[model samples]
Target: MPKAYVFTRYGGPETEAFVDVDRPSPGPGQLLVAVHAAGVNPVDWKQRTGYRRPGESDERVFPVVFGNEVSGVVEDIGDGVEGFAVGDAVFGTALAGGYTEYTLVPAAIAAHKPAELSHTAAATLPVAAATAYDGVRQLDLPSGATLLVTGAGGGVGAAAVQIARAFGLRVVGVASEGKKAFVESLGAEHVASGPGWAERARASAPDAVYDLVGGQVLAEAAELLTDRTKLITAGAPEEEVRRLGGARVARARNAAVLEEVARLVLKGDLDPHLTETFPLDRAGDALRTVEEGHARGKTVIEVTR
Candidate 1:
């Protein structure tokens, strides 16, 4: 039997209960992974708390397994699958069911775990890294362009800072005073502040801005965009992005960009910060970390091994 976290009710993380289940088998084109670690994201908790969109309600329901990113070794390969064999180490997103000892992922979404990253580090990539990559690509900003990222100390913001910098764009990261050092460690010029942060960011760059924070910060940042077309938000305030005539790229696909991100990680160009690790039984504590919105980067649950 394999242990897994299962949510039986829509409430807080406390509502998530750990249970035992038989190991899952891979279906055609699926790979059964012996999960080593699973990344925890805001979406996981949001779903558990019944905060998902109506369209997603059916899929993100109670008794549903939560978790998107997992890093593990392949234990079995279903028929019709090729290019992967037993014992291959890999990481990727499974729309659900990753918070278990075993998970089955479609072959297309799986990638070889970067040689340089541990299972904990690789588990942090799927949702956060993919969101950052897709957001950067959507902007299509030119090299040397000034890009401002909000929530720079958080997972997606941290990833965005590194990705933008790697692409040759100058990055100014906005984070709280406590996280300034962490954000700077990721190669961003850090601006530390609380409310009225946009005004401070304008004082520094006074150029094009990217609103990774969303909500009021997004609304304020949009007003300061040298070119409205240059502003982009990965979260919150979708209407504000539209009102300012800036582009909002939500519905950021997790599976669309993992291959390139994996390549970058493999090449030593991308380093995902896996800041905290919780055991499977402490999954609720992990969700609380994400819910508190103070995580330095990614928080993960070590499922097995």
Candidate 2:
């Protein structure tokens, strides 16, 4: 049996618990991994409260493990899986969940970890970095064009700013005043988030907007882009964004996207910015930091062997 953090049923932290369960076996096209690190994101907490993506109707079987991405070594290969072997270091979107000592990863979305990148850094990529990459590419703004990024201090936002900059686009990053320096360090002009933040961002004369914060913030960002197609969000539902004449970030969840982001990391154009890490026993605290919306960068759970 393996110990995993899980939510017994959808509700709140009270529904969550530590339970011992049989280790997951890889299915067809999947690989069993010995997880070394798991990335914590807002979605992990949101799911505990019954949040699901648009069209996601698969009923959750409790006690569901908690996590979406991880980096680790391969333990076993599933039927029909090729290009990977036992002991190969890998990282990807977890098929089951990632917060346990072992989990399954779909080979289609997983990539080999380069020796230079640490497990902590690779763990943050499949969701946050990959989402950022997709949204930025979706905008397709020209070089020297200004791209305004909302919620620019969190995991995905930080990655978006850097990737946009790497693609030769100028960036305007909106975040709390507390994160101004951190956002600026990512090569974006920091716009303090609050009343009149969008007005202040107008000074940058953005050609596109990459939104990670939904609701009113997204509506405000929408107003800044006259070419609505250039406005994209990983934050809001597609209908909401499309009604505003924008679109949601279309994810290309494949190993190709994972490899591209890894290349960006190796080329010095992106950093996962793993700002905090906790041991497996403290996974709840790590989730809370992101759920509270105060995390300055990516948070990870470092599972010690």
- Candidate with maximal lDDT: 2
Over 37-146, each residue of candidate 2 has an lDDT whose tens digit, in order, gives 99999889988999887778899999999999999999999999999999999999998888999999999999999999999999999999999999999888889999
lDDT, each prediction = 0.80, 0.93
Q: List the residue pairs that clash in candidate 1.
A: none
- CA shift of 165, model 1, Å: 0.8
lDDT of 1 by residue, 72-122 (tens): 999999999888899999988774588898999888788877666788888
Candidate 1's C-alpha lDDT?
0.80
Kindly give the stretch of ten consecutive residues in candidate 2 with the minimal lDDT sum. Answer: 48-57
| lDDT score for residue 117 of model 1 | 76
All candidates: TM-score: 0.89, 0.98
> After superposition, which runs of candidate 1 have C-alpha atoms over 4 Å from their true positions?
53-61, 206-208, 237-240, 250-256
Q: Could you tell me the TM-score of candidate 2?
A: 0.98
